[model samples]
Target: MLYIQLTPFPELHTERFVLRRLQQADAPALLDQRSDPRIMRYLDREPDTTLEQTTALIERITQNAADNSGVTWGIVRPAATQELLGTIGLWRIMAEHHRAEVGYGLHPDYWQQGVMSEALAAVLDFGFQTLKLHSVEANVNPHNTASRRLLEKHGFVQEAYFRQNYFFRGQFLDSIIYSLLTPEAAKPELINEAATEL
Candidate 1:
């Protein structure tokens, strides 16, 4: 596939939010986002239990971005104040395969507001347009209906289902794999435009 770097790191923007690289100052918000059981329910990792754990997570994400292995962005709405709403990222970036895994979480306060849906569209744009990725993948717990719906709305198709495939937090969980090819990723822009016309 031979994917080349488009930008070392890109700050993506949508009509209502900014998706930028995470920083140490965002640790408090990250802690809040990661610790929520509602947000962490389907994730493979445990709910972050401490500020130190959040700080460590920030460091790891920063390092991965630098290494070109992955990148995470803080979802910020910069209006009267720079408020962080959630986080989204492309991880396990496989340049040789031109693919990566997409992960995201939003504060419960902002859920059902179309915030994650908007932010993810921008991230997928960056992944396909900027990074030139051929496809993007997502692993969702089959029970997370809302999350699965969001992925489906973004044009990801169910590619596979693995029963009790992921061992996490002293239990195994079923996983449904979804994927969006670059061609499918392109529809979001047009979809947005069509929405605007109505």
Candidate 2:
């Protein structure tokens, strides 16, 4: 269940976004996103983090790219301002099983703008069709209505809802797990739209 190695790092694009390798230089842009309380609460970093920490984070992302454990794609807006707005990646690749966990985050400024969904659509296609993956799963905080809706919009079902899964912001929070298989994906055009490579 280690399809990660076979899943060659591929560059993905859409009308407004580009999915490509994450560089250490991206730390500053990412810090802009990570600095927000909303984005950092569920994440491992705090809002008042240092540049070195961002560097370390980018290094970890680079390690993922080098180790081939998973592929991290920096979500960028390739228009007048080529800014790194967010990140979308596939991790915990179980190639033998042809499944992996997908995760994403975007700057609050870009939230509710369909940016994450578009980026995900591009990646899901690369995962299922190009890499031949069979399924993708996601874990979200139940309170994250926007993210939950995004998953549902992409055809991921609410497979599990666990209470008090992780403690954050000085309190425990519940988690909702979502999953979408190839068969499930095939039924929804949105899920399968980018699935067919160009």
Candidate 3:
């Protein structure tokens, strides 16, 4: 059977995380976590986001899902943790090339808990084994050491550092390109063990 037929677009659930489709009602939860400057400062946002914008963002994500171009999974703790931990997405899908760009962000409170890394391992596995993507790339602002560290921990190599690639806030910011080949991305068990030493 074709890989797509086997698992083209199934929901991904992990031990502690539920990777579900985003809905409009999710906006308020997203706003609650991301509206804070601490969470959005390094993000590529307008810095001022209202509930309306968050609602619209969810709509946009749903549209992408409809078009089959990409989808955003809202990461939630199934234990009724009552917090939107973060999001994991396979955006900028290039079906012809069998590749996609991966992006993620988390509530600052969830940092250092290994939640994002654990979630990333699941997504990377989904990308390679399920979606049959040949590679996955993630871009992060160079100044965001925490993000850089997370990507590196997941077997992603720093491919390039583009100067003044993104305009966040008032100034041009450098962006770091990180990528993991399908074979490399598949070795999450190893990646997780390695992450322990970092």
Candidate 4:
């Protein structure tokens, strides 16, 4: 079985952004994204219409980290104000199986800008290297071509497609599953290059 520890809440940094813990202060920004129809369209959950809802969501994310069941990061640009541009996480952890599910959403303003790709690369590194996960999976709305493309760009392959497997908002929805497995070994040059990038 895999062992996991999320204490101290790992804060990851890439060239352009910082992946840090979500806080109550971030509720408003998060609400803006969660309440936007464009951002929430592919997500099954209802739009968060109130600050209270977003705050509760942050609280749950905190609890999940404390419980070591999951970890979520608010993606923030380092050079700019410390407002969240998006959010990402590894959840639905199956420690015995050394696997977890990846989920994310960005404010529409930040879309198509490679912001999520950077965040995802950092998270995947943490999931595989620090958490020792053997594989990571993503379940996406079938119509979310952008998400599918993003996962594929990160080396995730389509593992399965379930037709009308999800019931949401009075409709049955199809889901596409994508996955990436930890490589058996890292090439020396690749390892050194990754070391420098981080």
Candidate 5:
């Protein structure tokens, strides 16, 4: 296996967005996202009610990268504006296993525009090519049809079904796990999908 460095942040670019490290200035945008019901629909945690919480979250993400355990990026489009539209990241990174769990959150206003599809394509490329990961997984609420469709578009296969095994906001939620192998991470169709308007 070829070894790859997982530490030290790197910036990624897509046709319409830039994926980069979370910064203090991003707290407000993150706070807005977390507080929005539409954006937090399937998320496990409560809405971030304060900028301090968002700041702390950013700090933890930075520390996780430093420890080589995880990486998170804020998605921004330069020509459109500096405001963040969403976040994408790898969590529970098990280097020994050559795999990681991926997660993302986007403001509802930007949904169905292909923005996330674009951002995730770039992230998968970094994971498979740069980080040398064998596979990437995503866990989603079964009811999150949009997220499921996005994963499917990128060649991710449903790998597991956990019925009511997760509790969020006082309800037991069914979760589905989806995975994409490194060999299939960057397919031509996915690249084409990323170019669509977002």
Candidate 6:
């Protein structure tokens, strides 16, 4: 079994952004992202319509980290502002299998900027190097082409497609599963190349 420790709350940094712990003060920014239809369209979850709901979501994310079940980071451009531009995380961790699922969303304003690419690379490194995870997977809405491209660009390959497997908002939705395993010694330049391209 894999040993996990989230007590210190890992904070990751890249050239342009910082992935830090989500805090109560981030509720407003988080609400903006979660409520925006463009960002939440493929997320399946209902838009967070109020601060109370956003706050509750933050609490849950915090608890998940506290329990060592997951870790989420508020993506912030520290050089310009402390406001959150998006959120990303590794959740549903399966310690015994040394795996976890990756999830993320960015504000529409930051779209197409490669911000997520950099953030994701940092997180992937942490998962494989620090956490000793063997693999990481992502579940994406089939219609979310941008997300699909992002995962693919980061070395993830499509492993499965489930038809109408997720029920949400009175309709069934299809999902695509993408997965990436730790790079072998011979192929040492996996995520690093992707990160540098951004």
Against the reference, the lDDT scores of all candidates come to 0.87, 0.79, 0.79, 0.92, 0.87, 0.91
Candidate 1 has an lDDT of 0.87
Candidate 6 wrong stretches, greater than 4 Å: 185-198
Model 2, span 1-198: residue lDDT tens: 544552355778899888887777788888777777788766643574787877887788777766766787888867733578889998666777888899888988888889999999988887887667888999887767888899999988988988887776687778888988875446777656767754
**62-91: candidate 6 lDDT, tens digit per residue:** 999999999999999888557888889997
lDDT of 1 by residue, 2-48 (tens): 55552467888899888887888888888988988888877778788
For residue 176, model 1's alpha carbon misses the true position, in angstroms, by 0.4
Sort every candidate by lDDT, greatest first. 4, 6, 5, 1, 3, 2
On a 0 to 1 TM-score scale, where does candidate 2 land against the true structure?
A: 0.83
Candidate RMSDs in Å, in order, are 6.8, 6.0, 6.9, 6.0, 7.6, 6.2
Off by over 4 Å in 5: 1-7, 184-198
TM-scores of the models, in the order given = 0.88, 0.83, 0.83, 0.91, 0.87, 0.91
Q: Model 4 off-target regions past 4 Å?
A: 185-198
Tens digits of lDDT, candidate 5, 18-120: 9988888889989999899888877777888988998999999998888888899999887744688999998668888889999999998898899999999
Worst 10 residues of 2 by lDDT: 1-10
Best by lDDT: 4
Model 2 misplaced regions, further than 4 Å: 6-8, 41-48, 184-198
Number of backbone-clashing residue pairs for each candidate, in the order shown: 0, 7, 0, 0, 1, 0
Candidates 1 and 6: which is better by lDDT?
6
**Residue 24's lDDT in candidate 4:** 94
